[model samples]
Target: MESSERQLRAQMRFFHDLVRKLAADGDPYAKVLSAPDNPYPAYEAIRARGVLYHSPLNTWVTADHELANQVLRDKRFGVRMANGDKVPEFMNFDNSMLGLDPPDHTRLRRMTVPTFNPRIVERWRGRAEAICHRLIDDILAKGGRFDLMTSFAHHLPTAVIGDLVGIPEEDREQFHLLSREITPLLDGVVTYEKSVSVHAALDGMAELFGRIVEQRRADPREDMISRMLPLVDEGSLTMAELLPLCMFLPLAGTETTVNLIGNGILALLRHPEQWRMVAEDPELAQGAVNETLRYDPPVQTYRRIAHEPVELAGVTLAVDDELAIVAAGANRDPKVFPDPERFDITRSSRNDTLAFSAGIHYCLGAPLAKFEAEVAYQTLITRLPDLRQAGPVRRRGSFIIRGLQEFPLSAG
Candidate 1:
């Protein structure tokens, strides 16, 4: 334990010093890492530098919409180094599909495609709507004021994902806590306290899911875990692979939707005109979701490494060069989105947003996340037509997984 603690402290100091060094050097991407609350200015600075800015951190960065899309879709780029090494400091999802390249990524992704495909995800709409109403019922009981994030936004995705993952209702709270603890690691920003919490959370999740795995082996159920157990027995997957896959599903599923709902509602409330449009005609809920995704995305950036030498927009990237693709910046590029800074629910070309990323690694859960947010907004506007901000909102300290930490609201 002492040795592990020392290692954790050392790692934290290293990242802190690295961030300070880069920030001092005026590295725009590093500015986004150090102070992420309003990264748009730094993104604009990167755009000012040109299509591709080489950061002191040695990664090629881009805020250009077309170039970002080209890099994400290009077969010459991948999530790993050319030598097949995983990027350091990223969440240890290396065992899961999120960290794998082709063949393995294709294999694991294919296994779960049916589960998150639009048709199957659409089947969960009633359950999602019911969950939303139930959460609002709790919010209404709070005497017209409450933290929307904890009382509603957070619970909606957690409950839905909990049910889908076959976690018992009694254990859902613990599951949510562990998932939140692990989310900060996504940004590659680590403090000593966060490091300790994340380690404990990972251990807790392993124990919790291990028990479920054994139970499903004994008594098969109609859920994601039980469905995949056959693959484990058939030599297609091992216990080593199954545990990480289980962990990845809840982590990825919950965080994305939770942030989507929170960020979307926050955007609407900040722009009352858009809020009024949705409140007056809830059919515009989908439009509200699309606009929210473009205006303030849940995920701000993703990384890709050149698997081979590639030329993009007058820049030559050598093999193994890493690029930080700023999706948030790309979503707001004027070339693709006119008046990109304005949040308009009625925008016609909102679908061009890279909010869910692009190409082979496009979010598998995008359909489910959008459906849940659409249901969430529609339900909130219909039930709490007077919903508005009740206090100052706090954004989470994660740059990669952008979201709210506290969002107080009044049902009014």
Candidate 2:
């Protein structure tokens, strides 16, 4: 199994290198990195090329808000090839519903919806609040400067999702350690070593969840795994299907929320007036969350492949042609938003953002993620009224997922 896996990774690495060459030599992706802290200029270049610009790298790129929404909602565009092939040339990771197209996509997604129902997720609010306060207390106890991403942002969502998914507390550290390695593949820039690490992390997580599945089958509890066990037993969902669903929760829940907190806080701090606004009125926490998502979303790029020749943005996409919908750029479209560059929590047009994306593939845990950020930010502002940046920020090295990997902050 290990040898076969290594061979698969060798193929993936070769493919990644080929794609990198294509992107660097010909694609807009080559020019998309304006700076570690800002990629909007790169996105602006793509937008300037017109609504639908064809890349020499053999993909169609769009930063237009209407075009992005049309492509996402259009039935002709999907996550996979027309004939059902996976598109992860950098890593052999399958995102379940995130990878599937309708009837299959609809079926699998429907089964998971009840688990993430607004009411069910709302029940997690108290726990999310408690986690926020406990983390703040610990950071305060340590006295002066701490890495916000590591100390608070990363751990909070990991624990919340861990609890929600019913992973045994003793086993969660190993789970998170592995997830940390695997999440970067979302960026689509995988080195040979990183691909190997991702494979190992996925395998280890599968094993951990496998054990939990068996435990839930034997001694049912009030957790998500237990809730879904009956469906697995009766064949509404197979064991094979169950594992990925369990894996998706944390995979979906963690890094995005972590980045949201880190990026949103940074945005607020950079615009001190906005920070003061949220700090003064805790009610603006949700407004802050919305504005940050619009200004600097966690997931920066979304992809779709045409299932058939489809006319869009005054051009027809041949079957299997990839569409790189840059939502980060779309969120700032001046047609939809005035002064698109400014980060304002009070802007009425702010809700026009495509941060959680649009249409069917929109984030399932968006409510939970929003609530988590709200609580984290609200608590931080109220408790650490004097919070300020202590050191240089290190942005994550992936254009697809925009976030700060390390943000040093101090509370006076």
Candidate 3:
């Protein structure tokens, strides 16, 4: 094996051992997702190893926010993780907006950014509300306890994003499955089994998007896809760049908002006093959403690779070294946020909430996602009038994304 590949294998072995130990020890490390802190205990554990742990694939974890900002903003670290030989459950390689670097990144993000811009996303308010209203009605009609994660939380954003991105309501379930198979890309294991399913799903999506692009070409509409056609005509964006954003933008929009809604509600339920405050004045709900992001963000960590030598926190990383910016940890560093452990809904905003990521690679759907969370929560609070956690919130074991897998809730 090449030296980088050897390094990757060595690192993977070490991480596996760490995971095993954390699992055995339980508490903070193993239940990484159970609580609000970044890396859970994972950050501190890795920090103990050193400010930077050699990534098995030339990757290391930079859990410090300032260091994270330095890496993400400095333009030295590339976003793509060096995949030597292993293909985990997801092939985050091509198509997805999150995986690509600049030039191509510039083209892809440009096509969709206009659509997700605050002015445009603000226009999505009515459509987002309509979708939420229908879902809430369905839940209320059932008149019993419901699974918030799957039922209410999951469905609302998918419907909202589907409407916004021109995805037919019928295809959302399929998209959800495809998104689930691919979300593990950040976890560093794109297994063969998942690869088959994910490839099939991606092919189907690409084919579907191809057809849509063709339709938009023949008959333009008032959607983002139509607006993005000029880029394709200009040859700045190829089908690969366009296809991923088409699906990715919508999926990202839905996924993060869904988790934030679920996570925020759960947090308030655990802290009833907070819930009571929001119940009294729904405007505070927006603050609650921001707090939940800091407390437990939907997207956890993102990986970057160094092409040239880079110095971080006095440690000089050799060329080809890998780095994982634990956005979760960066959001909680005590130096950045006072009492980072406490869940204060009204904590003044920090310029950096690595939750949306940093540098040129920041999330495209951030405004849309935040808007959806605020709107969704407001509608629910006003409509449900009394929403509370109904059962234990189950968490998915995947490392990249965090939040409720099953958030059982009731509305009165």
Candidate 4:
């Protein structure tokens, strides 16, 4: 048997023991970062805990690309691995659109589609650059010293998503906190205090969306929330369903983009030639973005259960056994992406990479993600001119979302 395959069988026994320990006295935080230096290396040994890669608690960590395409495409298999009793655990249920499938997903997606249209994306071209400029300026004004994660990568996406959703300029912080709090990757390891803050953020979002929905009902605006709020007024959308859309959009919108930008920058800084390539030929921004997604996908894993016995890579999974589609690992799978680890942006091959996933559940925010990164990096290379990493940076203590927590950069 192949190494990965052999490891899978061994994990069946090893993972159960690990889970038993974790259930009792394991420190989730310490266990998460136990192999922070090599996060992906240990994934093979952990997936056999009932077919789903169980984390210390509420874990979804996989990186296989083709499986991602299969799982994401099969809409019947939704996110049902939750352990929420008081409320749907992991992601707050709250009757959100994400929990709804088919007619609901179709209807909500139709309403949400207008905001992501090509023309609307074109409208944000300047807005995207403007946000980039504002962020870069903050760094420049600070004498080329800034936390790229907090100061730039983190702020721009929150601001941009806010602008898209009709959030007022002053209220961006609320959205930012919500984006961070709601990501399982970030808060899965949060303490009781952070848990309080996460709930507070959810409450704030619900309240904010209440007003926004009401405002849009009275007088529709050009923003996305305005476009979708009418359905609610017409009784087409209810609080239970609508709350998730309002919160999910910003969190989904900004969360991954922030990580993508941060990861892309770090990857390029590590590979100066690639940086110089983008710096020289501004057009390479798109390909560079694609490569970044393949190299270190922001959302590492998505899940699906076998409706029937499924044969994936010769591994026969039993019916109803949970399967983790590791987008990051899939992106690196040699079968799909040749020389997966070299970080070569110019290497052209079929990009069936599991970054955005595939099929019906393919990331709804993909068009937005690609557009945002293309615009942001194009501007970064051209405007910043001297963007370079300052020192060693750390990731956001997250196993699911991949990116740096602190990226210090100097832009001359």
- TM-score of model 2 vs. true structure: 0.94
Taking the tens digit of each residue's C-alpha lDDT, what string does model 4 give over 287-340? 888888878778775556555565655456565556556666667766666777
Strongest candidate by TM-score: 1
Tens-digit lDDT string for candidate 3 (1-412): 6796566556556655655665556433333423333346776565455555553333467667787777788777676533322223132444476666676677667667777778987888898888788888888889946887777777777776676676655667877777776554544444445555666877777777788778778888777778877887888777666787886777666778888888777777778777777778889878887888888888877767776787877788776666777788778888889988788887886355888887798887787788788777777777876777676667766667776778777775
Scored by lDDT, the top model is 1
- Model 2 lDDT per residue over 295-341, tens place: 89998889899999999877888999898899999998999988989
- Clashes by residue pair, model 2: none
Is candidate 2 or 3 superior in TM-score? 2
Candidate 4, residue 278: how far the Cα is off, in Å:
0.9
Computed on alpha carbons, the lDDT of every model, listed in order, comes to: 0.85, 0.83, 0.71, 0.66
How high is the lDDT of residue 15 in model 4? 49
Task: State how far residue 183 of model 1 sits from its true place (Å).
Answer: 1.0
Query: What residue runs in model 2 are displaced by over 4 Å at the alpha carbon?
Result: 1-27, 33-36
Of 2 and 3, the candidate ahead on lDDT is 2
